[model samples]
Target: MIACLRLFSALCLAALLAACASSPSSSLGELPRTPDATIEQLLEQATSAKTPEHAALLRLSAADMAFQQNNPARSAQILAQVPLDSLKPAAQIFASTLTAELAMGRNQPKAALAALSHPSLQNLKELPPEQQIRTGTVHARAYEADGQTLAAARERVAMAPLLTGDAAASNHEAIWSLIAAVPGEQLQASGNPVLDGWITLAQAIKNAGTLEQQQAAIDTWRAQNPAHPAAVQLPTPLTRLKELASQPLNKIALLLPQQGPLASVAKALREGFMAAHYQAQQAGQKPPVIEVYDSSRVSSLDEFYKKAQADGVQLVIGPLEKPLVKQLSARPQLPITTLALNYSEGDQAPAQLFQFGLAAEDEAREVSRRARADGLHRAAAMVPKGEWGERVLKAFRQDWEANGGTLIGVEYVDQPVALAQQIADLFKLRQSEGRAKSLQSTVGADVAAQPSRRQDIEFIFLAVTPQQAQQIKPTLNFQYAGDVPVYATSHVFSASGDKNQYNDMNGIMFCETPWLLNTTDPLRNQVTAQWPQANGSLGRLYAMGVDAYRLAPRLGQLKALPDTRIDGLSGNLGMSPSQRIERQMPWAKFVSGQIERLPDTPR
Candidate 1:
């Protein structure tokens, strides 16, 4: 029983405890200490003992004692049974406050707020100033959790005038900050002015500080309010968020070029998606009934969407063409997540559509990230001079710049670079400097002295064919390029595994998709079984069609990544915040013309 006749309110209350308490811990660490309860304590305060006030207070005391015994469920049960009619005005307020606190302890923020709304609970004016403040402060937290920001703020403003400071003042401000839509820097001063001053002082360090400054403020806030919810328990994602299978399937339309030039490929993908429904049925999940709209069937894509929406299709996936994806996404057909098979036409990602293509730019960034991590800070590019080649070149430049690496110079070569000749041309000037300095430095030492600049050629980016990469990369073994790393794109990966053709590609890296590798998955094996016979990589695209179908309805989850992180039929993926897929270059080096991984790249 703490007495409270104070001038300032206890504005620094620690809230958000509800968010923390519900986080599931893998293990219950240990049992807490036990306490002895004396029945005599209940009898000691028996003044007008038969009254509601006396009864409610006694029940509250018993409930608290149960809570102290590590039995929260029992404590809440006891509080609920307490008779409220006999409670005096002060006792009634205390009883309701305790009710809300019990809800908080039980991790029921919504219920806690509901409990505060009780008529007896809401009539805080009849209670002592301090008790009213404590009740209102906690009630505000419930409102915040329910997404009622205005109500929470209103509660704070109304109750701030009632509190007086105590050991609990620090507890109040932490809660206030969480539910606040805007910073409470200015308004905090009006509440329990003493604690308000402390919070105001905190504002100086919290306003748009550097990363270090922000971290320090976070640490300070935690230290001052150890029990604050966000401090002790983080907002961990509940992976058990009910999966889509349990949900009613939204009508998702499939738009593919099933009747056009890629009709065979499109049909293959349609079957792959059909396989998904079969798999879902086997798993006892509701299957989505897909309505396939052949892009070749409709003269206009806008009609495809119009028909689908008229038929109640809520989602759409496919139409691999970039132009169609742009038109469909500009105005979404429904409140659905549509996935396109190409890059967004512009930087503004469509709210209704997302891109799932294996974007070339994404591969470049991955290559650059790996290069820097390998301590390859300086790079050069020998790229082709066409639409595809120039695109790869642009990707390389952007990736290098964004990653703090410098591009010394990029040479355009339409044919496979004369590996030895290009290496000689690039390094001839540096070599000439050495020859000129022969008189100043030891000739043997100069010969032994690999120029520091030579070592700076940490890596090389060559936009060429597997045959080209293979032909040129090995020539480097005897040249300066041999000492530097080499990187490329899927173009190099597309070679037909001609061992003799790629004999020189023993140590070159490139990006690839998951389908590029034949997985042990029976579906993958079955679809591409003849690939080995034809000695072709066409089966990989076949599998892409198959995998696409299985992933279609799940388009909402697949391409909708929150960051440059995505997981696709390709590899572990990155996604833009707008939920577009961002894939990486799965690096592989040629091992005897059969792709093998370098030591650092994952197998």
Candidate 2:
């Protein structure tokens, strides 16, 4: 019996050794611990790997090294060799994460998200914290690129526990920025306490009336959430905000033409600006004193600046005319910070000069971004034949081609008589008809065929007046291209409320100022009540005026924080590097002769 027991123990020992030999660490033996290991060495090792699993592990490491070396093509090649389905759970997760990183490098965030959704990521926690952090970072970036701001913040928040040192600090700040960029309407409490704390903090800052009130709100939030990440260390922007609270904007100079061609435009702007000021006073805040100056009466910008300085103007709001803005842009610096209501033609400008206006080019760029987000790659444009049309088309073409979209065709709409011909030519209906005619001639009889529009054109970018749009939409249908989507700027929308006019513009989508889309805004309602024309297209200028008021105090904040976006009445206002304010407007579609608001698209 003793001899039998000894033999049985030896057999058990042999089985245990076999299990140890096939363990994960041993099976993945020779896998590079660091990406600095030459990819060639890892690839060489992969060739002679003893097991299929070993081969995949080595190749995955080689692919990661290739990615680190910035050879995405080589990394993709090596990754393709790794058979993911047959790999261990950890290896599979690594493969998916690397695939996601590659997709992100190519600017394909949707593909990156799809790759990261591999089933093996469910076992991601089983891997090392480093691996988890890598996956989470890529996931968060993809979400951010794909315009899922809240999701990106949540991912960064989840990564907080795994990160340390500078990485942890950066991740923490990114979380705050992502949450801060979210529109106030979208800020709601998710069930997670950490995320909820962040949202509540952002809401507190957004809803507070004055700088002192904002500081108090921040203090209240930090006290309530003592252990929160942001509470422990406030975001850099919030810290800056605290510093800005000490310096208040007590006076502003509003410079606009009062008796020139722009007089009517200036009237709407002044009223909108004062309406916001009155609303702030009603809310029990010490609003700045606004002094109006007539640019038409002023002969020199230098004298205007000196006078503004003498008047204790902390900021100069405008000189709405293009010629005045061009003059301001030529200067190296200004006596006081000027927020010009018009943008200069020159690309360069003084650091102190910030430009904000209702530029049609902003909406044109929006069309390119929105079309790309909707997965359309080919576009054709139809703009009125003039300098204004040329400007809009130039903006659209630059943005479209930059995002890898093809401007397949363009038509200049000058006269109503040529509308049908222009539409047919743009869609290549003539070419289709010519081909059918050639075939019929060869067959010696007429072949029944409809002239079909080109299949390559994905959508049409329409820039026209509402009257022109009414005729063009129906003409496009007559040319057998009604099914193609039509995107337009705010110009296409007149806000005329004529159902018969809108009926012809059915199936068109346009981006317009929120001031027109949302009639319920308190300030807008009040302004419209006083100036009934504020309910029409003129409301866009009024909205721009209101935004200029909102933008004056926040210009410094926007410059300091590059990612900051103000939910303005005009649009989601953001500052470009050139100090020009850009807008991401809301979309609306004409359906059955009624305007239907579309959800905001990815920016």
Candidate 3:
């Protein structure tokens, strides 16, 4: 009777373990009531299995269950007990792949590669397409973990043809993201014809600006390599590419105030636009013939428009001053499509005119949106004392309140005392002091009093220069509101300031063009190399010029598909229904006297 009881207990344990290992879901939802108990039970059952094959299969199932429960170390331990060679070919592949994946999860890239080196796992094409793709993905991840980024990207690109539906879309996006991360100059021709073709195609697509150029590029590639496999699959991406490319703008007229207060800015823009033109020309593209018109030299925008029309210009890209832009917008019908450098004052702009500029109001609105996204609900603002500052503050308040955030307080400061008093009022520091005095009086003896700032304020929307920011940030901390976050526009970053000087402005977050923040970008480096004098204030204008030249041809696509965004040098360029080209810039925080880019936030 004692021996039979022991046998019954062993059978019950094996049955429970078998039931726990049967479910195959990737998540822990299918695990037994107690995962640890199930794993222990599985080990006991594996040791008492009837045959070696049964034991190996039981161990593999336990390893999978352990992994599902987020126990990678235990999973690896269970996998080690299994004799992979004793299993069937499919089972061996399964065990090896799972071990490799778990090893990768533990950041053991070498161990992962070792596990994947099994003979059964080699020659993945022998497996079904789905299995092959899965194994290839693991190999690609292993390569990435080992710091072989190009190798990883090439692995995915090689399998791009086999992916379909959501898999294909995700793979395509990953491939492009990796390729874009590598500088254009570093993309050399791989010895393989297929890879070389892909490299060449990627370069061509990068340079192509319009539908005609894209189609011509595809035709050229097809003619060069008629039998390549990519040619057969080219139509898939082409459909999406067609949505981004629009009709070509062969003749463009650039209008600027060449001899006025804005002449320096205009010069920077002209140089930047010409730089893009030269780049396209060098890439064997038939760039638009651009004509420069001095808005200051012409009597009115009408004369420039007529002149541009007579020259058969397909698009007009200027009128930099706001008043001039407003004048252009008031015209009954523009001779050609005009991309105004500045937006008009009214809500509605002319139908034929599209506006694109680095506007202060846009930056303010972006700052408010970012603050709200950061979970900051109550805001206080410190703005400069001027018309531009008023516009920025008003725009920020409107956007903040519209997004269900409250504007707790606002102050316009032109001096130190003004800023201090405004901050004190915003935080109700004086009220705290008055309350502390009243409590001391009620205590009927001289006592130490502790004042507290208002807890309602969550963030500060600061519109100030870098110089002002340096002085204001520390003052806010001294005033007992240091814990509250501070957000600002690109104005807080001079882009070429002394890094050490910005140490005082630490903890300030702002948004700026990737062109300024990512100084290592190939295009930015090239532009800086050519025009070493372009820095600080003019640098942003230069980026605007490069994007404007690229945007002229793609405007129709932006308008047609609201979801479309072109990755431009200035920022991610998109269009609003009001004909304003919106810029979505990257975010950065000043840390240790340097501007560091924040992790990308989802749109």
Candidate 4:
């Protein structure tokens, strides 16, 4: 009898041990219910499962819910014990994604970024376009948290092409491109605003009447707050900014100040506009009667519009000054389609007025996105002091944070600030933004964990012109560029100051439009071949002409039905179903003096 009791005790001990040895850490004993689940219940059930795979899957299921409930630490701990190899591809992706979220929640952005970059998570790309975008964003955020800004930024740039196919569909390309202009760590309880905006617009595209109406609809939704997208660059135009690339020409107005103080700038614009006008006639495109509105003659835009109405003009372009454009916003009920040119002054163009100019805000935002995407998180901008610096810095700060990055600081070349003050400010911005940890700490533990000496900083965005850029590029090489890639804005393209600026310009990347590409497209080829003989800004004018001509005859249709968007010479054009022109801004990199298209620009 004593021997029999001993055997029974042995059996009981063996059973307990076997349960603990089972796959998935908790074993089949009353596995605690996931934190959201009764942890006790889950532990019990999980242990009861015979294999680790089963137990891990159950844990994953529970963790997902927990995360949805916003308890990431618990979710992370629960997942830590599970080996996800036994799970299916979709399930594996989920597990990896959840792990990343947990890491992020723990304030270990680097860990989250690393987890998202894991080979196992690559399978997440197999998910739907929407899901890929959603998952990719989380992964990007993790990189941002880990101080891997460029990787996060690249994920965003790549996303625009992915979310919206190269071909224009209800202007998805433009919307995605705009949204991608901002990048950063993904902590949004909802989701990335750019992705959300495109998805919402994509869903509503079929039902909307015109691009104008669609934009108005988007704006209306945004006003309510709940449905607002999580993206910084709202596919503001939500449709193509071009209205006339494919249509017949009727009558188009050139709105530059053909007779003012800024006459040279206006003349540059006019020359380009007229060259495009002649090109249209030469291209067998129905030529629209080109009318010159001496913006100089009109004391105010209010009077200008009244005259425009009297002339039966179908399309209006320009107002080059900020004050003039701002006035139009108050009286936007013009009978024609207005494509107003943009300027630096503090002008808020009307919803109906499409403004096109290289505003500092746009340049800063573009540089931030590109640099961050390329994996350069540490950025030190050197700008002309005062308003320009302030303007660029404001955008840089906003966009840098939005992209999940911190500015290393700003170096003001402005005279009043004093050289010492500027230098002090520069180092101060760097130190304050946590550059200490970044410089001293390893870039990636996993990367370093491996036996390799490969260290590269993705891209650096320098917002300086040819002169300032020339002055600064050497310092970056000697003091900063150390194996780190550099990036710049269109201003970098400004002519050489004093000497061979382009020669001095090396190792910088920038963005531009389709016009710069050496494409086989007949229209592009024509411009490429003829540009040498024409004026300096000839190509830009041709683009304007092509776009304007397409829009001129269609003004009536555009105003009547504001939802329709189309392709144009510049790129895919759309309007926020609200009448504002939308554009898919493509970017390029400048190596030496030549600009090369990035791998992700829309075809």
Q: Which candidate should be chosen as best, given TM-score against the real structure?
A: 2
lDDT by residue for model 1 (1-603), tens: 133523222322222333223211212111111224442455354334676544456667776677667787877777677765555444555666777777887777878876676666545564445555777777877777676654565566566545546523443444444332233334355454434433433453335223334345555666876654444532211011123323455566888886656776566556555655565678897666778777777777656666887888866768776667676656644345566766656656556666666566667766776777777778888766678778877877887886578988766665554555576666564575566578457554534344333555667887776666666676677664576778777667664766876666777777666656535555555445534521244543554555554455444333211211224455565446565666654566776667775444431
My TM-score estimates for the predictions, one after another, are 0.54, 0.70, 0.61, 0.50
Model 2, position 77: C-alpha lDDT score: 99
Model 3 TM-score is: 0.61
C-alpha local distance difference test of each model: 0.58, 0.89, 0.77, 0.56
lDDT of 4 by residue, 1-603 (tens): 999999999999898776543321232122222354565466566788898766766777667666777877777777777776656555566676777777777777777666666565555444545546757767767765666544564466445456554332423333344333322223122254545544444344334544445556555655544543323334433324223233444667787776668676676556556656777678796676878988877876667767877887767887777777666665635556577675424444444566555455655776776666556676666677688778877877897887678666556674532544344344343443344455446564322221111122244456666666665666554443434565565666642222356546665665544454435556656554655422232444455445654555444444333344456555445444344444444566555665556764322
Model 4 scores a TM of 0.50
Identify the runs in model 4 with alpha carbons over 4 angstroms from their true place: 1-249, 343-351, 415-460, 480-482, 495-499, 513-603
Model 1 weakest lDDT span, ten residues long: 24-33
1-603 per-residue lDDT for model 2 (tens digits): 999999999999998766544333443332225645688888888899898877788788889888988999999999999887887667777888999999999999999999999887877665567887999999999999999999999999987999999999999889988988887788899998999999999888878755677789999999999999899999998898888777899999999898978999999998899888898899998889999999999998889888889999999999899998998999898889999999899688988999999999999999998999999999999999989999999999999998789999999999999999999998889999999999999999989999988899999999899999989999988999999999999898989999988899999999999999998899999999999999999999899889999888888777645556888999999988798999999999999989999999975
State the lDDT at 323 in candidate 1. 69
Q: Report the number of the highest-lDDT candidate.
A: 2
> Model 4 Cα RMSD, Å?
15.7
Residue-wise C-alpha lDDT for candidate 3, range 68-158, written one tens digit per residue: 7898888988888877776666567778788878878988777877888888765455445665686678877887787666677787877
